[model samples]
Target: MDLSWLIPIVMTAGGVVALIALVAVLARNLKKVPPNKVLVFYGRKHTTEPRHDADGKVIEAGGTKGFQVVTGGSKWKWPILEDCQEMDMASFQMKPQLKKIPNKDGVLVNVDAVASCKIKSEQSSLSAAVERFLGKTTQEIHAMVLEILEGQLRAVIGTMTVEQLIQDRETLNTRVKAEAMSELEKLGVGIDILNIQSINDDQGYIEALGKKRTAEVVRDAAIGKAEAEAETKKRSTTAAKDADVLAANNQAMTFEADKDRDVKKATYDALIKAEQARAEQAGPMAKAEAEQKVVVQQVKVDEERERANIEVQKQKALVAAQAEEAKTVVPARKAAEALVATAEGAKKKLVIDAEGNRDAAVATAEGEQKKLVIESEGNRDAAINAATAEQKKRVLESEGARDAEINAATAQGQKLELEGKGKAASIRVIAEAEVYQAREVGKAQADAIEAKLLAEAKGILAKAEAYAKMDQRGALQLILEKLPSILEQLPAIVEAAAKPMSAIDKVVMIGSDPNAPAKFAGNVPVFLAQLFETTKNLGFDLSGALKKLGIDATAISGPDAPKVD
Candidate 1:
């Protein structure tokens, strides 16, 4: 191959290939432009036509039909016939500088705030309409955004004071959001929020307002404190007045009570005086009545004395008349006696015969006395014999009684012996049976006690092991101290056994010894003394036992020991 000829041909081929690649790139770029941007076509007329609903209902007039809105991607169109401009839908922050406009209160304040917004679809379409009407540029959009936000912000700031704008940010923000949102919505744009970032005002005005509020608060507090003090004083005054009124009432009541007491005293005194006067009159009136009665009784006595004197005089006269009559009858009686004497001689002999008969009667009585004497002697002899028989009978009865008594006594003794022997045998049998039973029981109890003691010992060993491991000297010391107390109770056990056997012979024979075992001879006293000593040393109680022994615990310590009696 010839190198020189091949170089020109290769260069020509490379140029052709490059031209093809350029055309392919231009075609690819044309395809890519449709996705990245949008195109809007505007006709000669700037006015928009009315839009219609899908249901053929008439809607508001909007952008002209020659103009079209393209969003998100590009559109294929004649470049000469349409103009395409990109209006961003993304949010943007617009800080608008606004001049101080006086509020309703005529206070000037500079309002600084931020507005967040995005272009609306309808307003973006209106760019084509605006190009027809005014022109198409960012300047118009920026002017529109600023014009809307600035008018709204100025209106908001003008409605409020500088203090409100500064302090009440939330209220300011709410006003901004409302006004800006409504305005932006009307313009087919979206506003996120309108914030009053800051407000600049005269410091003197703010400080004066703060001082005024503080003074008002302090004045209110002072007024409240004064009112509280006044209320307390009023209550104290009222309480004092009430106390005075109560004291006066008590004084009045006391005076009334005293007056009542005086009235009662006067009434009691009058009653006593009247009673005394009546008592004094009663003795005088009684004396006068007694004197009148005595005078009447004396008159009756005088009348009775006069009547007695008259009766005595009448009796004396009657006695004298009877004596005269008796004296006259005495002479006649003497003459009659002389005549009777002659006849008496014969009468004397008859009287002598009567005297002899009387003597004979006397002699008969003497004979009767002798007969009575004989009968009396016989009766005396009979009485003596009867007395002798009675004495002999009494002696026989006494002898029989003695024999009967001896027989009865012998029988009673035999019966008592049998009964006593039976009773003693029964008691001995019962005692033996009880002892046998007790021995069995004691063996069983001993076994139980041994088991319990073994178990306690095991437990004590376990506890001691634990205590030893822990080195607890206190527990070991307590057990050692208590050992004597347990041992001291042994005497009580013996006493309990012996107490039920008081009727048994005092000299007990143990192990077939007739004489008491040496150990048993003084065992009770020795055991008791040992128990007392052990209990005393162990601090065990023996006051109850000392009482039974008729000894006072306090007295037993000295020469003043109580006497056994």
Candidate 2:
């Protein structure tokens, strides 16, 4: 009876429940994409518009079984018509450790690197990333990225040597990132930062190389130190020698200065004495000049008297000569004129005769020259004809003689060859016999020499053994004991030198110095000192030996001895 009122109440409640159910369904379909995430809705009949590519080319899209992507924004799913998924777009760091990877040089190395990777955020990249990594956890994405990075890193390391890996880490990182990004791009993954942290090898080659470089540096330092020390010593020695030379030069210069001073002093004294002598002789010289002038005047008066007498005699002789000339000159002049005219006539006659003879001689010489030229031409022709004929005869004779001689020589050569062969055989036999005899004799001599050498070697060995056993003092005593015998041979030294000198006819000591004998005597001691020095150099220590014998070694071989020049 109350059914109508209950029906209205039930319908109102049913409507309210239906509204709440619809709101809940709408809320469940809505999704939010955080700044670090991307939302992807994929199902049938998507409502997303087509996107323009980087070149602004339009793509036909929508109304297809495809996915819609929303990055850092909100997106709604059309319940049952589409399903939604979220992809982490946030960057995460991954450490990729590649172990025992062989490089270009086939050296096994381990590489460790840190990389930051995320899903691509670009429209096309985001669509690609949503298709690949949609609904994946951050850890799972990190693992996938690490694997890709490690594979790319191994590929990069295989292209480089351990040295390049160690020295060029930046290049390693760049190449690894490039290769990794190329591969990850297909998976819609991007690499933001990639860094190679360390590269190492199990082998100790790098340590050894460092050690070798350090050793080389040490060697250079040692060589430099030695060279510097040698240079310093050389400079020191040079300075010492220079000081000695300078001191000697100073001493010599001092001697020269003393000598010059003495010479100047003597020269001044001599000049003063000469001036005093000149002063003392001046008055006497003046008086002697006055007396000499008086004598000169007297001599001049005597000369004038003699000159007057001579003038008188000359005047008398002149008068006599003038009279004689008057008596004889006219006739003599006439005779000379007659003789000159006759000589002139004879000269003309002789000149005419010479011309006639010259013409006759020239004509005769022309005839003789023509005759000689013709005779010479005839003789030359005859000689040429005879020479030609003789040459032909001689050639024929030489041909005949050559043929005969060749035949004879051939016959003689055969005979001589037979004889030479016989002689050679005989000679060979004789040489063989001689060689055998010589070999036997030489063998015998060699045997004897070998025996003698062996004996000598044994004796020498015995002597060496004995010497080795003796102390230094014992050896010196033995030397002292044999000193007299050694001295007995000393006369030979004098004789050896004097024998050559004795063969000379005379000794000519020709030197300008008066003290040559003294100098030669002085050189004898120097020579003796040099001789003793030579004996010491031969390991005898002659001065020490002499000192042990209580002899004064200083005279010849001690510190006081004269140095050899």
Candidate 3:
């Protein structure tokens, strides 16, 4: 073979085949589809057209007029009439920087968030829809996602307080998720929320917020604790008071019952005494009645005997009168006889009559003597009976007087005893009242002191909070540095106010070396002296102030110094 002739033919054939293969490769490449991507073709249609299927249902690939969508492949088309675009269905990752303006709190927080999304395989029209509505670039989608995320974050964060945002992370996350869902759903994009990449706020504002929250939490905790303690104390106090009141009521009831019992007992005793007195009087009355009955019987018997004796005496006197009359007649007859001897029988009768007259005078005198003797005897007996009756009456009267005297003495002793018991009861009541008053006064004083101490502690706590929030270390250093000066001035102030400092010996010192006792002691006395000297014009007693600082004359003199460790 001639090499030159064969080379031309070969070259011509190779060029023809090469051109054909190149065209075939280009066509194949055009027909082949990329995975998770789509190509859309529009034919001379500037307006957005609805795509549908053959049955008049909306289609994902072909539009109603002349638009067609090719998914995951390249298609051959007429260059003059067809326009094509690529829509990626692959997962896309984006980080959007978002700025949120807080409402009413003047807080501007910047949020960096990431979003992942992918086109739905079932909704291939998404790319066309996106192309029509938004620019067919990742920048616009990224902007949309950022705007949506930003809006959602702001909407979520704006509804919450800074404290809630800072403290309640879960609530923030939930709220963000919800807001993002609502906003992203409207963007026609499937979204996978990754994370809030970062959040940033002004440093000063964050510090301020932290301080404010800390202060608020501390204050609230303190208030709640104090309230709980106060409530517990109040409940305990109320219970104690109720118990005391109940006890007092019981005591009063018991006292009243005792008083009533005592009164009843006294009444019963008085009744018993009265009954005894009545019994005693009844016995005396019965005895007196018996004596009276006996006396009546005896009197009756004496009366009968005396009457008989008087009758006998009267009969004897009558007999004596008769005998005397007969004697007188005989004497008269004798005298009459003597006279009749002189003048016969008639003269004798006259002499007898004269003798009888003389005898009658003598007999009458005897009868009169007997009558006088009987009368004397009767008078003596009557005198003796009357004397006996008078003696018995006197004895009964003496017995009645003795009983009356005894009763009076007994009543006087009982009255004295009752008065002593009443005096003792009055003394007890007064003592109890004084004790109660003292207890109440002590309790009131204790409560006042507790309140005062609590108020002082609150004031101190408020000052500490303000200082700590302002500049924590600086404020602490300032307080520590000024403590000594404050302590030194206190004694002078007290002395200037004409108050004694003997009770205020313990003073707190700060910024002084704790291990070196002399370091504090040496400076403290000088500070006290300076303070006292400054207030000397105000009539402050320097010596008294020094003494109050535990720097007496002896302490100032020798090696003995106050230890301040």
Q: Which candidate is the best by TM-score?
A: 2
* lDDT of candidate model 3 versus the reference: 0.57
Clashing pairs in 1: 34-74, 48-64
- For model 2, residues 354-396, the per-residue Cα lDDT tens digits are 4555455455555555565566777755554554455445545
Q: Model 3, 81-165: lDDT tens per residue?
A: 6756666667777676666566336687766767776555544436434545333587766666667766777777677766676
Give all TM-scores, in the order shown: 0.32, 0.37, 0.30
Model 2 — TM-score against the truth?
0.37
TM-score attained by model 1: 0.32
Quick one: best lDDT, which candidate? 2
RMSD of 1: 47.0
What would you estimate as the lDDT of candidate 1? 0.56
Candidate 1, residue 48: Cα displacement in angstroms equals 15
Candidates, ranked, TM-score: 2, 1, 3
The 0-to-1 C-alpha lDDT of every candidate, in the order given, reads 0.56, 0.66, 0.57
